[model samples]
Target: MTLEEYKKEFTEDDAVGWLEIDKEFDRLYPDQEPKHYAPPISYMLGGEYPLDGVSIYESKKQTDHFHFVTYGFSELYYNEEKVNGEFSKWGFELTFRLKPFEGDNGNPPSWAVALLQNIAKYVFSSGNWFEEFHFMPANGPIRLETDTDITALVFVNDPEIPKKQTPHGEVTFLQITGITSAEYESIKDNPGTAEELVNKLRENNPLLITDLNRK
Candidate 1:
């Protein structure tokens, strides 16, 4: 979207951005009450981090993977000046579909939230943004105490939803898909190998849940 377009959008309503994002998610999920967390203070005003809050939703029917979404990244608060750019803040918020490991409680581990917060810190402090087909290493196994083999992550557009344009800018739902250490190295060795990775993943799993045990 152009700068002028974004300006006019906010001029019309000034809330069509983040409000639309919330409405979209609510429409998709219906009336499910997901576990929610919000910092007492916003990072923009000197709190913990950039994301104002995060929601963790566990499917009662499925009970395997958790859906995580961040609120602070995409114009969570009204700021006409900040939303004037091409990308609203970081352009997108992060989402993760994670599996509950063995011996885990119904609640997701605290580490997952910390990981997401750290990523937000990186973007807010570094001024870098993420996009689809962008993959990065978590340095080690994503689950620190777990004996999981998955050590990397790749970014892709969330399969269930498409990108949306907000008054702030365009907000895309960026899902974090875990990859094996070997697969991570392979991508680093050859940058354009994501196509092959996607094809291999599509052989059995479609949602691409982060399977720590996947070989």
Candidate 2:
């Protein structure tokens, strides 16, 4: 989903927040002019973002919450000068607080799950601005972790070859983490049912489950 669509679908108060980066770097060997290389990096607001915002004391004082980090990488190319190259990388880190809506009910709200999943999909999806990407979970399992309320997810993107050398190259690897114990058990108990759950979760929150199952 586009940034505008994301904003529209999830409100700032919906226990979800994210951070994004779009950057360009220049490489130079000697006295020659610097070539421009733009690499985009996007991230969702994770435990780090909130802590940086309200001070460590405030964030540490909080009891219940969730955190996630994701990264993406796109193809790169040298500018006309050939002195440098351009590579696109986008990523996001996110954090969510359950206190806002926890007391409302016993079971977690669909919106909460949807929001988290949506953001996850955006970070891991190949369709995004990245040619390839990887996700890493800070806490537990990568795919489905439902046993715990608070969890952390992370993603990273690294290209095998330099952008100038292989502008159209593909991503070699991707990693994701932060699965809950309950989620693990669910999958373990019901072998082939993981796909069904993934589909259901994606249907509810398209933002988080972008093409994860695709080879």
Q: In terms of lDDT, which candidate is strongest?
A: 1
The residue ranges of model 2 lying beyond 4 angstroms of the native Cα positions read: 1-169, 172-178, 209-215
Cα lDDT, all candidates? 0.75, 0.30
Model 2, 1-215: lDDT tens digits are 34454456555453222111111111211232321211122234232111112100011112332222222232222222211123222322232223223333543333444444455455455444322222223344223343343243322221111222222222222223233445445655774665554445445433232222222
Q: TM-score for each prediction?
A: 0.85, 0.25
Count of backbone clashes for each model? 0, 37
Which digits, one per residue and each the tens of the lDDT, describe model 1 over residues 81-115?
66545666677878888878664665676677887
lDDT of 2 at 209: 24
Any idea what lDDT model 1 has? 0.75
